[model samples]
Target: MSFRSEPFLWIHLAGLAVLPLFLELTWLGLAIAESLVPVWLELILLAIVGIVPIAWMQWQKPFDIFSLLFVALQPQQLTSQQRQILRLFKTRKHRVLTLFAVLAMGWALWKLAVFAPLAAPAAARLTQSRGLGLGLAIVGFLGSNLFLQVPISVLGVLLTSNGQFEVTEPLTPEEVSQSVTVLGFRVGNILPTVASNNL
Candidate 1:
């Protein structure tokens, strides 16, 4: 069925679009996407979904941090002091997340280097029939995208974090303001303070 024709499909697709928001700590969107689909198709679907956002997350350096800032600032909601604390928390959260990503990338790369070489061949064989292979291939692509592309990006983040390379700075005031406006539009008046801050 076409994506638009099926309500569930549309919902799932919409979920995918907002997946980045859920990447605050873990890759929640990717995890959700993985859970919704079959294990056989996980790799391919995940791979396709993985790359750009992961890159965006790492490049941005404070995706979740900014999210928290938006949360605290949006409400008037919180005192400026509270917003400052939230910003501190956001920075800490970013640090924790960065640590986890580094460890995960290291672990995954080790496993991939050891097992991926073998697994890919086996998966390729099981999917001998064109139709089955096509589906399996899609799953594989998603998996690779999720696993490899994301890890690669994380490695870039790791390097940047560790001082081996330079990384882009966090979003500027203008960008933050724009994002705040967008957030208010998406969420509503409870966050009017953040919307006002944007002005």
Candidate 2:
């Protein structure tokens, strides 16, 4: 079901939206708090944000967001040259995922630096804030979004275009499905759980 189609999905999304807001409020409180607060508490809150969504996906695999993202990918039409490009990317998925993982770790470091002050407060929460244990949170945001679209879009482009080369051929539905299936592997290699069926 679409996010707007059903009340439950909407309700679930709306409810989940509050979580980040709560996290933001806590960060704000940390930034402005006068006394040293428990660092573990901040860690736990970040953990909850990461766990809840994945848990939701685990608990409701078919209806989760990944399924929604790939729903329209089945009619994946591609030219013969485009298919060649797809094969090229598929051949080196390990390298691609490695790159993504490295970038993700770099992002984690960025978050730590950004939240450092809150991790160890020196003044009031409003005046000072930071985090010592925010790695999982960095994983949740970047890993999820990065895998969700950036990689998919890259593959999608190759699927629909001949790159600098141009093509002129009438496409068939079966050919399209085959090309889309190839793309599933492209993204699947990066994240098996997210692209399991596509693989």
Candidate 3:
């Protein structure tokens, strides 16, 4: 991977490793607040938090997001056609959409906490700490978005592109020096060898 793409690789991998933990924490929080708020409603809020930011990112920078998953050449290295393709991803809109999405997520968490004040459940000592539960839920949601959402959003863009974007194979050193590759992977296979070769 290029220097620019390396950090994103780490974020994506870390997110994959911790995704289960976050999911469990979120569920535990919901369980604690089951009496105060419907689990389904909380779940819907979580979905909105998770999805809106990604949608905004897609709208703001479609091809730019692909750099998070694949090793893409620098903007200067791209051909006019390639740059034009990427340029299409850019939008004239301001950053307000992304900001609003983040604020909305924070608001949802705040609402959850306010509706279900943190107090120890009278019934079970260990299983019923509303405060701890809400805290965990908040952490899980934030962590999920912070670490995993970019990579997931990139995948979403790629899948929906319907082959509009080009992703080449790992470029040999010789080819790298002489050619301009759009998007490629530095290590490992995005698809099986046979599948890639067939393509």
> How much lDDT does each candidate structure score?
0.34, 0.36, 0.45
Q: 2 or 3, which is superior by TM-score?
A: 3
lDDT of 2 by residue, 1-199 (tens): 1112322223223343444443443334343433345655654454455434433332222121222333332234332433333333322442353345445534543454357566445324233323422433435443343333233334333344343224334335464444333212212222344334322
The C-alpha TM-scores of every prediction are 0.31, 0.31, 0.39
Candidate 3 lDDT trough over 10 residues, lowest sum? 1-10
Candidate 3 at 96: error in angstroms? 21
Candidate 2 Cα misplacement greater than 4 A, ranges: 1-70, 93-97, 103-107, 110-114, 118-199
Clash counts for the predictions, in order: 17, 15, 0
Among residues 3 or more apart in sequence or in different chains, the pairs in candidate 3 whose N, CA or C atoms overlap within 3 Å are none
What lDDT score goes with residue 17 in model 3?
72
lDDT for model 2 comes to 0.36
**Model 1, poorest ten-residue lDDT window?**
1-10
Residue 92 in model 1: lDDT: 38
